[model samples]
Target: MVKSYHPETLEEALKILVETHCIPYAGGTDLMVRYRQGPGLVPNFDRPVMFIGHFPELTAISEKNGEFSIGACVPYRDIIRHPHTPEILRQACSLIGAPAIQNLGTMGGNICNASPAGDTLPPLSVLDATLTLRSVSGERKVSFLSFFTGPGKSILRDDELLTCIHFRLPHFTVEGYRKVGTRKANALSKIAFAGFMLKEKDMLSDVRIALGAVAPTIVRSRELENRLIGQPVAELAELMPDLLKSYGKLIQPITDQRSDANYRKTVSLRLIKNFVLKEES
Candidate 1:
């Protein structure tokens, strides 16, 4: 039998996690690989595992007041189907992997895995999403922006569990996600970009930009976007050179098996330029 605790309720699950210090098991897509034992043998985990994948408390998508709450175990397919999911988020989830993986991968796993290349991150970053972390003691909220400490690391505590994600749609006339990878599908991204631009009467009202797989964590610069806000959209052509140069200083991509730093850097700037000056290129 699988050596995992299948709790009947969220409270029991949290209690098990705290007492046994067991790793929370959801889809086990990433964890299984990370802890793989062999071709046919069950994955080896250092400790007991708590299976929370089917708990209704962690699998439902619902809304209250003005905010939308997506459970931690909610799959990408569910997110893609939800009418309330932001277009940017939906696009990111749609391209995370093939349909099979999407059906099993949860945003909680993507987030808790904390890989810099995790596809959902850039979209969630720009969305200004918050995660609800629950412990037997109580619960508190954490900003997604500050959740990740570095590649493969996060601020989530040992006794806590990420229960849900929260976000509200913001006004943006332009929204898009652009990813550069070896293959169109089922490939890790060399660079991923999520952009949101709000322009009014040809004057830029707001700009939100996020880049992933180029830094320690998902890269978002409110400072850079603010500089472009309130500027004439037509004059973006004149401003882009300097803006791109500033971005060049902000992102740090390392050469990896998938791609090199120079190529990743070039493609990132081009994608950003296209988003900002949609009319020109």
Candidate 2:
């Protein structure tokens, strides 16, 4: 028999999650579709489910001293509307489904889903995000870059709940985000790319680039970005070929339902090249 739990508090929810073998339920935008059992039929819940979507502890959004903390269960709609949300993140959230899915989908769910094509992952990666995972034992923060192990896989334990995400927007003046998909609305990304740059006195100080749906994980190479730091922004054009080659070597996109490997890689590199070498505006 299957069981369901709706804990009144986040603590109770964490307790139940640890005490029972169950899946954490939130938004259910992905779980419902994944466990669907046919029209009008209850989705199959093989073990148990503990509902945490309504916990206020997992739905707040706030910023302090330029650092922002977003509750794990915050819906995309709220993130899209939050004033302090980075423009890249806000734009990615707005592109996520129609208003309906945005209203129901949470960024925590998106991270936990660990889909390579998730539109928000690229932005989160380049933003240098951190995830807070909690359980009855305690909570710990992990870098967004280290959270996922593979497609639909993450280090999140059954006993743990993702509580919030934290990140500081770097003092970057140039930022870009792009998502390629079959359709403009409610479409999953074929390839997602995000880049950020900070320049001072014609010299590059920071550069971050993340590519999604093109690898086992969202691809980001701080090593590569660091190599370009201190170089004059105008020189990026001279380094385009080598830079794209390095980025191309980093991404391992696969041919799947939405796109081919070659196309994903080519388009992603093109986006990066454009971001770095385009004329200043």
Candidate 3:
């Protein structure tokens, strides 16, 4: 039998989190599958389960102070459809799954779960997103890049819960997102890439590239990004091989059921080059 609590206010919820030592449940899309399956199927759940689905504080998404505040419980479908959300996030969310998963899964749940293949994460990483983690005592902010510690782990503490994700809108950001799947929708990414590049007056002023399923964590190709900076994007198509070389050095892929290391690396570079070419044109 599972124990549940519905705390109306965040303070009440935090208090309950402390007192009951419960593993907070958000959408339960991931947790429910595990709870029913058995021990090896899911991570061990020593604590009781606390439901935060209906918590009023975790459901707000609005703009403030030149940045957007995305509530932890806000579903991917809503984020994709919201007029105020950045296009990169919306585009990523659209490819996360069909309507069913998007309607039920959430940005916070995705981040907190820390899945390397999480569709929304690479986009958020390129967007320079930050997470707000809160507890009864206080709140702290952490960058999206630093938040994910490993494949299925995060910097989040036991007593802390993710409150909101925040990001500043880029002035000349071109959003590019692509996923490699067996089919178009509702397929796990063999490898996925999201990028934001700025090319004004034919000069590559800036670029951010992030890849999922190519590494233990979502990786930002800083070396490739630096080499691409200040170059004429019109000429970048010729530099694709060198860029791929740098990216290949940075990413550590693995042979898994979904795909192999070499294939993952090849496509990772190809996708970035493709997106860069498209953005420049």
Candidate 4:
């Protein structure tokens, strides 16, 4: 049997999560569907679920001191529509699913689900997002890169809840986001890519690249980033293929229902290369 608890306050929610030792569900896009299909959403939970949707603490997106703080329960629609949200995240959100899915899915749910094919992870990785995890005990920040251990896995303790995602709005950065699926939207990505380029006086000074679905976890490669930085924009076309090859070396994709390993590997490279070149121009 499944037990449910809804707490109106953050402290109350945290206390319940700790007391029950249950999984947290906000948007329920992934959790409800998975639970309906099987017992796999969160397996073997001795405690019931603590619903944070009603918690007033986790439902806003606000900016302060050059950083945006996104409450865990803020739906994708709200994030995409918010005037202050970054353009890359907005574009990614628009491609997430249909209007209803967009309205129901929250950014925090996406992160905690920890799907490699998750649409928003690559964009968040580019932004160097920081996660704020809370429990009855206290709260702490975790870098996005170090947060996920694998598919459906994260560093978040069972007693803890992800409260907010905070990150700086890109400055002097040209952003790009792309996802390749069977359909334009609402299709799970076989391969996805996102990047941000910082140019100084027409020269590439810094670039961050993140890829999804091609790896067991969403990943950003420092070597590939280093290879492209300091190079002239004119050379990106020639350099793209090699960079893709390097990216493949970094991530070993698997054959899954969505796509074959070969296609995912090749398309991801092509997509990243194309996106980077487009930003360069």
Assess every candidate by TM-score. 0.96, 0.97, 0.92, 0.92
Residues 24-122, model 1: lDDT tens digits: 978888899899989999887889888889988889998766588899999999999998888888988888878988999999999999999999999
Candidate 2: worst 10 consecutive residues by lDDT?
Answer: 272-281
| Clashes by residue pair, model 1 | none
Local accuracy by lDDT, each model: 0.89, 0.89, 0.83, 0.84
Query: TM-score of the candidate numbered 2?
Result: 0.97
Model 3: ten consecutive residues of lowest lDDT:
35-44
Q: Could you tell me how far off, in angstroms, the CA of residue 96 lies in candidate 3 after the best superposition?
A: 1.9
Residue-level lDDT of model 2, residues 91-159, one tens digit each, is 999999789999999999999999988888999999899999998999999999899999999999888
| Candidate 4 lDDT, 1-281, residue by residue in tens | 67878777889888887777777888788877776645554444455877787666789889988889899889888998899999888988999988999988998999999999889999999999999999888999999989999988899898788999999988745777888898987799988888888877767888998999888899698877999889887777888778777777877789988899988877777767766776543
Model 3 spans with C-alpha error above 4 angstroms: 38-45, 279-281
Give candidates' CA RMSD values in order.
1.7, 1.2, 2.6, 2.8
In candidate 2, residue 42 scores what lDDT?
Answer: 89
lDDT of 1: 0.89
TM-score of 1: 0.96
Question: Residue 150 of candidate 4: its Cα lDDT?
Answer: 92
- The alpha-carbon deviation from the true structure for residue 105 of candidate 3, after best TM-score superposition, in angstroms, is 1.0
